[model samples]
Target: MNPERTSAGPILITGASGQLGAALVKGAQAAGLAHRAVQRPAFDFDNPASIAQICAETSPSLIINAAAWTAVDAAETNQDAAWRANRDGPATLAAYAAEQHIPLIHISTDYVFDGSKGAPYIESDQVAPLGVYGASKEAGERAVLSTGAASMVLRTAWVFSAGRANFARTMIEAGRKRPELRVVADQRGTPTAAPDLAAAILRIVALIQRTGWQPHYGGIFHATNQGATTWHGFATEIFAQAARHGETAPTIVPITTQDWPTPVRRPADSRLDGQKLAAVFGITLPDWRDATRRVIADMLTQPASAP
Candidate 1:
């Protein structure tokens, strides 16, 4: 499986406008790593030509594909757009990466699994996406892995950050206006902090940079903060942390999945086992609780932004 690798160049990050993408950009800048981040107009999945143009312009040594159509419910109605962003866009990047012998790191979602599995899922588990969004992402994973490029598909879940619209921010903002909020408790997954995931991605980049591309590094890896909780539990924690900054805590009524139905069917339990990531990359994200605390602090300390 050993293949000749291209010389190192600036890391190219797609979906720069996203929470994870923005965090990656910030992390790269803080670490002083050479990186180029791009979003829509300049680089977009809807515009296939833009992918190649951005790649050519960046001449990236390694690519961290943080781009994807993440709207779970919207995917049901907008299947084509979801496919373009999730599957087609990544396929294009993978093909180009293969042609140039560039290593790629593609971000994926935990939704690939149907959450039928009672326990945490390992990388080798068969994927059974429950909805359009998950199905599109599963297709993207196949495209990236099948290209024969030095690629790693990192499957993460419940990603949030202060930089964008996310669960934590939504909870805080909504709690301020409402006295009580009903959060779905039946669904279970780890809440991954964007900055933590970003830091871990950079660590992988460093490892690849230090040791050169390793064949074993090119595969599926589950990456999430340690521990799992329901959306209800997550909101409770978010409020607990937010309250430290004098924000009011609303009464959170735990509700079932049926109580808060959406267009897409989310996994009942999608906790990803990250032992593979720890063993392979020697990286583990901080616990969700700690990550939540840090993000809440960052959110409060920073200027207010639209959710």
Candidate 2:
């Protein structure tokens, strides 16, 4: 396919079915940026030829890669599957973007850190991945960066969105089924809204275009809400908001990560410092609580059944 012929137009987004991808589609249209959202049964990350073909065919001036293997604990046993999507998939797209000389916007995760440190992780912080999913994500981060293409690697944590199944959705469902829910209280991070994150990506892209990438806004940035809260706190908020939405709220029982043991070792603190994002963008993200409330409101009021 002649890619150069089509490179003169709108942005192209991958993982359209995912929450973040859906948000980007809406955000791009709302922001008045010409764009396309590609997802399965049309776009499949497991197939490299498909990825290459679409990249060349679409020839998007900007490519936002939101596709990823997000099953954290499942990665412990499904390592290859995770890397195929998380590492090789990104590597393929980044290589194409580099060759085409177009900017690639990549989504990353906060699990790259081991979480032993009791402070928020900065863009420059050392990474010590504690699990298979984390390792795969770290590798994918390097893969995209190594391409030397203009790219933005955004690492966010505790994402909950209205369009997809997430912590908030799970809590709301369990709250309806069970009398009480036990959530981990030790782990902490900003409960990023997928739509908010989508907005951040677009803003970065706009900034890159306006600023001419001089500041190399191409590297890693921690984009999330302004504050940190534990899983227990997050669940409590979800339940409370559900009640406010005229729905039944479940009692949330707080528990440590050990008490709610899982196959993977979760970071005690998934907090990502947004200082650089704020400084560079000259803006501060709203608190997670506010974002969460918006998401809950959107979910409860939507016509679709709540997950």
The number of the candidate with the highest TM-score is 1
Model 1 agreement with the true structure over 1-307: per-residue lDDT tens digits: 4553645679999999999999999999999999999999899898888998999988899999998899999899999999999999999999998998889999999999999999999999999999999999999999999999999999999999986898998898899899999999999999999999999999999888877789889899999999999999999999999888888899999999999878888999999999999998888899999999999999988866423
TM-score of each predicted structure versus truth: 0.98, 0.95
For candidate 1, the lDDT comes to 0.93
Query: Which regions in candidate 1 have their CA more than 4 angstroms from the true location?
Result: 1-7, 305-307
Candidate 2 lDDT by residue in tens digits, 95-207: 88878877888899899999978999999999998899999999999999998777779898888898788999888888889998888988988899998889888887787
Query: How much lDDT does candidate 2 score?
Result: 0.85
Q: What are the lDDT figures for the candidates, one per model?
A: 0.93, 0.85
